[model samples]
Target: MPVAAFAVVAGVIGAGPVIAAVQGDPALPERTAGQLLADAAQASRSGLKPMSGTVMQTASFGLPGLPEVQGGMGGASPTALLVGSHELKVWYGGESKLRLALPGRMSETDLIVNGDQVWLWESEANKATRVKVDAGAHEKAGGHPKPEEALPTAVTPQQLAQQVLQAAEADTVVSVTNTERVADRAAYQLVLAPKDASSLVKEVKLALDGETFVPLRIQVYAKSSAEPAFEVGFTSVTFSPPAAENFTFTPPAGAKVEEKSLGTLVGEHGADRGEGADPTHGRFEDGELKGKIRTVGDGWTTVAVLPVSERDLRTPDTGGQRGQDAGAIADTILKSAKPISGAWGSGKVIQTKLVSALLTDDGRLLVGAVTPEKLAEAAGRK
Candidate 1:
């Protein structure tokens, strides 16, 4: 297995255009649901080179407790960057060569990943962090593979499609509902609807390219909502490989430099993947969520529970210290979390469109792509 190279380029997942049910052209070969998924997985992994596109994302969790996010979200991580619009020019030249140009007030923040050398040049801060990409990709055959470097737990449409197809088949009703276009490329809309009514997610729709079978776009809709609560896709794309210069960058003179390995740079997030069916575990180095991690169930309806310790909650990792006041940050998030109690006991709940988590006062976190009831049930269990 190779290290996934996809990063959170421009985090703004929004409701995409309505994919209408239409007849597929009779001229085109028909594919069964199983066949389409198998082919898509294979195609997404092959011949990915020299591609450039506009990455647009609009996100709205509709959670009241989220600070700085009143209506919607756009950027990545932390609540502060949520609720806005951001567009980034992304270039992908295989897994070793990748680039993202984010415009800023003074200059621009560019992330360049060329081979083992990865550089993040932030013009505003005049800082550059150069690091070696992680070595998670030692193939059994020999040497390293060209697969992308994994970022802080963020997922791409193609990656999500593969994960869902592999792990969520039994838990969801999979179907091809509509034929649509993304970034001017014709695509098939594969819809995955959860069979479990206790899950909050209404459905996950993936638009796979007609020819390549690569997932061009993925949209997740909350239960009862026609529009997607989170979506990401290429607004405009070119299959031709980007120029070599795109993946190379040089920081300005006098810029402060802080270098760390990709693992160190991502803190604990590099290993924490919290998708519904995907199993993941890690200590909360970021002080957001930490504890003895474990999954409660399997498949799309699966839930995860982590027992938070008093020490982990109190400690925050600031650059200098173990971190800023970890305790303070946890306290802030806990304060905002809505309070609730039931047979499963009492806890504060952070409800978002894509995921929901239950934080008990007793220091337990139960999270998943499930409803409150599902989390509560998991919580009540010994």
Candidate 2:
């Protein structure tokens, strides 16, 4: 699908009022579960019209609180999204022109993707990084012209909705719960409940815009809680295309600018090389653990096993203060992980409301939405 442009923005710590579920419910025409699913799938494949909106994400993982990092980088850092409530402003003018602004108390971070050029500017640090995407290379990877393939992984509501829908066909019961009004637009609530009791996720709810069939909100509920452990949605939205100027970016005069390219980011491998390739033969590069990444089982019970060597766990001398900060955070998380052992050997297991992870002494890390026992079963496999 052409969803590569949907994840440029991420969550940030902030506060906002709860958007009402509408006074009662919008009087929208009834849509059968199958029809809604088919329409949503088609909408995702076709992509959405140019639009702009404010997004809100809240996470309550039921795990120990993560220590907040200091400085301008902290606001946009991945850790910030794990807990608390946050918001981001997004402008999408087709796949080639997009913008994401994450606001903080004293500074702001913006990511602008215009044409083949992408800019990441941080106000707090007065730094900017410009990435040049080769259109030919991007096209080889996927028909979608997205430069985010060169960046770290991130999940958006629309992207998550599609993934959940794919997994739902095999292991979930899909139904239309009711009508909802999201982002001031009428929507249909489609709920997918897991058929496997061993899975930690109770259900996933998606609110699809009645007119466009675009996913406006996504909520994931855990088996132990009635409330969603993770929820993301638009607070306000307009389907009209944003101004062209919104995608243009110019770094501050005094900001340090670093230039990069898609080839430099992904190494010698062509962007198209990884499709259906054996991840076990993948190579590690640029701080990413590539090799030894593989999945077990199928559907909602799938377990992804990643390798983490002793060197990978140690604090690196590079990246200066940021590296130290990241190492400290990893240490804290490891300290909080529960020690576990079995016929599968010894390791630490981190259990959240909807996910479970086992970091083995043998350097293998098994993670999935299934129970810890399920992880152990996968571990015991050859």
Q: Tell me, by TM-score, which candidate is best.
A: 2
Q: Tens digit of lDDT per residue, candidate 2, span 6-87?
A: 2221110000111113223446777655455456555655667899999998999887666555443324545666787988
Runs in model 1 deviating more than 4 A are 1-29, 65-77, 81-83, 114-118, 127-170, 248-291, 309-332, 336-338
What number of clashing residue pairs does each candidate have, in the order they appear?
A: 21, 0
- Which 10-residue span in candidate 1 carries the lowest summed lDDT? 5-14
Q: What are the Cα lDDT values of the candidates? A: 0.59, 0.67
**lDDT tens digits by residue: candidate 1, 91-197:** 88886898988764456767889997899876656778897665763443366434322211225544543443444334456556445878988777666566668
TM-score of each: 0.69, 0.73
Give candidate 2's TM-score: 0.73
